[model samples]
Target: MNDPAIAVDGLTKQFRGGTRALDGLSLRVSRGGIYALLGPNGAGKTTLIRILATLLRPDGGTALVAGHDVVAEAGRVRQLIGLAGQFAAVDDHLTGRENITMIGRLYGLTRRAATSRAAEILTRIGLDTAADRQVKTYSGGMRRRIDLAASLIGRPQVLFLDEPTTGVDPASRHDLWSLVRDLAADGTTVLLTTQYLDEADQLADRIAVIDHGRLLTEGTATELKDRTGAAVVELDLPPHQLDAAMTALQPLAPRRDRDRILLPAPDGPLTLRHAMGLLDQADLTPTDIALHGPTLDDVFLALTRHNTSRSARSTA
Candidate 1:
C-alpha cells in the first residue's frame, strides 16, 4: 500500500533508567482518516504519540508522519502536524484570540495575516464572541475550543489529539466529536490517543490497541469485535436471587455483578432464547435482559488479558 498518513515500523523507545516506554510498536493510519490509539494508562500510548509528534526520540525503528521521517525530517514533520495534548495548551494570561494569533505568528505568519487567521479560526470554533476573553476566564469547553484553534493555526495536514476530552462535560464531549468529524471530513487526518473505548468507537475509522509498550492489535471497530467472536448478554436478576441466579445461568455466565450476569451468546437470538428459557425453568425471572454486539471494551479486555497471561509465562 502507498505510504499511510502515519506509519511506524518497529518503533521503540527506551528511556533513562532502562524504562521501556515503547516496544517495537508498529502502526499505519490511512490518509484522510481518523485513527485512534487506545490503551489504559501506562500502556505507552502517550509515549508513542510523543514520538510521532517529534517531542521524544525513539531508540529503534522509524516513524514517518505525512510522508516525512520523524527523525530525519523533524522540522518538516512539525510543519505538517498539529498536536493538542492532554492539558489545554492555552496560556491563561492570553485571550483566546491572542493564543491563536501567537501560534500563527510562531508558524511564521505575518502579523496582519496571523490576526486575520486567528479571527477566522475563532469564528470557526464558535469562540468569536469569547475571543477577547482571557483564557483563565473561559470555561473548560471554551479553553478546549481555543486550544483546538491554536493547533489549526498553521493548517497542518495531520492533527494529533491526546485525550482531548478527558475532563469536558458530556455535551462538550459530544460537541468535540462533531468538530473532529468535520475536520476529518475536510481531509485532515487525525491520530487520537484516548483511554475511553466509547470515544474510539465513535470517532476512529480504525483503532490500534497498545499495552505494556507493545501493539496488541489494530483494526476497524467491527473487525476487532468480530475477532472476539463473543456476543455480550446482560441480564438483571431479582435483587435477592442474584446469588442463586448465577447458578441457574451458569452456562451463560462469564462474569457476575451485583444484579447483572454477563456471558457470551455467540448464537445471538437463539442463544438468548435458550438462556431465557433456562432462567424460566429455574423459576427465576429477569427484570431486564439484553443482547449486544461485541464492543471495543470487550475486545480490549480480552486481548489485553491474553497478552498479560503470555507475558507472565514468558517471564517465568
Candidate 2:
C-alpha cells in the first residue's frame, strides 16, 4: 500500500493528576516491516501503543491505522489490527489450542474455521506439539509464544507488540526475534514498543527514540548510532589517575563505563588525537585506548545526557 500502516499527528494525552503521557507526539509507520518505539520506562511508549491500538483515547489530535481513522473508524481499525500486550493473556487452565480458537471465534470465525486457524497458527509459532497442553504447563517462553499465537489467529494486517520479550530467556528471545522477522517477511506490519536497546537495534527496520512523550530522533539503527559520531574513543586509564583525567577531559563530555571513559570522536582520527592531547595535559597515562563504531548503547548514552526522563502519572 502507498499509505502508511499507522499515522499519528500531534497526539496529546494527559492524566487526572496533570501528568502528560503523550505531549503532541506524532509518528508515521510504514506498512510491512518492524517499526520500533524505543525509550526508557514511562517514556510514553506504552501510551502511544494504547492509543494506536484503540484501547485508550487520545485527548488531542488524530491517528490512523491502515488508512482508517483511529477515533472515527475504531471498529474498522480493530478489524485490521492484532495486539499482544506486555504480559501473556492466555488462560492457564485452557489448552493452547483452545485459547487461540476462542480468540478466533471472538473475531467471528465459525467453529471449524477457528479450529483450523488455531491449528495453523499453533504450528506456525512452533507450538504444535504443545497445542493440547494446558497453558499452565508451558514455560515462560512458551507462554509468550502462545499469547503471540492468539494475536495472530485473525491474521491481522497490522500487529502491535508491546514489549514482546520482556522476561524471556536469551534463547527464547532469539526465537521470538526470528519469528517476528519471518512475519514481516510474509507481509505483516509490526509496530513494536520496547525498552530493550538490543531488541530495537536488532529487529526494527527503523527506530523512533522518544523521551518525555515526544520524539527525540528517528532513523535506521545505523543512522541513529551515527548521530553520536562517526566513531567512539574508549580509554582505560590507571585507576588512580581517573579522577584527574575526568576533570581534564571535561570538554570532551566523557562518561565512564566501568573502568573505561568513553568520548565521542565525531571527527574520527582528529578527535582521537585531541583526546590523547587532553589526557597528556593532565599527565594521565592510560592503560589502553581504541576507537570503534558507535553502538545503540552509545547512542542512548548521548541522548539521555541531554534529555532526562520524568515520571508520568499513568500511561501503561
Candidate 3:
C-alpha cells in the first residue's frame, strides 16, 4: 500500500495557560483526496493544522507530511506543503500578480520563473483579468483566490486550507470549491478545516470531527450518517395539534419543538407511513410531513452532544 499523504499518531499540544489544544489525536489522509477537519471554535483544529504545517511544534507524539517528520524535517515538510490560512495573507499594497510573483520568488524561483508562474496561477484561478489590480481593490472572494494562488507558487503536493471560505459570498465560495476539487483531482492532497458542515459534506472524501481537543469521529459522509442508524420523520402540524401528534407518535419517541414533531424512522418509508396512519387514526392532520436521511449536521450534533455530556459528567 502507498504511504499516506499525511499522518498523525497520538499527537498532543497545550497552551501556556494549561489549555490542552490537542489530545492524542490520530488520523491518516490518503494521497489525492480532500480530508476535512470539522470542529467548533477552539477545538484544536487550527492548532493541529499549524503543527502539521510546521509553524508550531507539538508538545508530544508526532506528525508527518508527505512522509517527512514535521518536527525533524521541518524544511522538507515546508517544501511539500502549502498553507492558506483563515485570512488572506497577500499584501494589500501589491497587485494580485505581484503578490503571487513575490511568493514564487520567496520560494526561490528565478525572477523570470516567478513571473511566468505568477501569470500561470492568475490564469488558473480566473484572476487574470484583474491580475494587475492591488489586492486592496479586490473583492473578498478575489483576495481569497489570490491568497490560494500564492500558496500554490511552489506547486505543493499537500495543501492545508483553514476556513478557506468563512466570509466569501456564495458565488465566490462555489468557485473556490470548484478550484479545490480540481486541485485534488490533479493529485494535490488537501487537508482543510471548515465551520460549514455542508462544505465538508460536498468536498471531503473523509471527515474527522473534533471537540475539546479530542477526535470525536471520522468517516466518509455517508458512513458517518449511517452511524446515526435512523432517518428522521418531521411532521408539521397546527400548533394546537402538537400535543396530540406527539402522543400518537410516542412509540417513535418523538421530540417536539414549536409546530414540528421529529421522530426516528428506522424503517424509513414504512415507518413514515405508519406514523401518518397513527396521526390519521387520531383525527390529526399534518400540514406537512417529510422523511430525511441523517445529515452531516445530525452527525455533528450527536458527536458534539456526546462530548458535552461527557464533560459535564466528568465535572460533576
Winning candidate number (lDDT): 3
Local lDDT at 236 for model 1:
88
Each model's lDDT comes to 0.86, 0.88, 0.90
Candidates in order, TM-scores: namely 0.90, 0.89, 0.88
Q: Write the per-residue lDDT of candidate 1 for residues 59-105, one digit (tens) a residue.
A: 99999998999999999999999888664667899888888898888
* Candidate 1 residue pairs that clash: none
Candidate 2: deviation at residue 237, Å?
Answer: 5.3
C-alpha RMSD between model 3 and the true structure: 2.9
The Cα error of candidate 3 at residue 82, in Å, is 0.3
lDDT of 2 by residue, 1-316 (tens): 7999988999999978877879899889999999998887878888898888888999999999999998898999988888896745689999999999998898899999999999999998999999999999999899889989988877889999998998899999999999999999999999998878999999999999888788889999999987766588899998888888889999988888888898888888888899899988888889999999999988876686567733333333
Clashes of each: 0, 0, 0
Candidate 3, superposed: residue stretches over 4 Å from native = 237-261, 267-285, 313-316
lDDT of 2: 0.88
Clashes counted in candidate 1 amount to: 0
* Candidate 3 local lDDT, 68-101, one digit each (tens): 9999999999999999966466999999999999
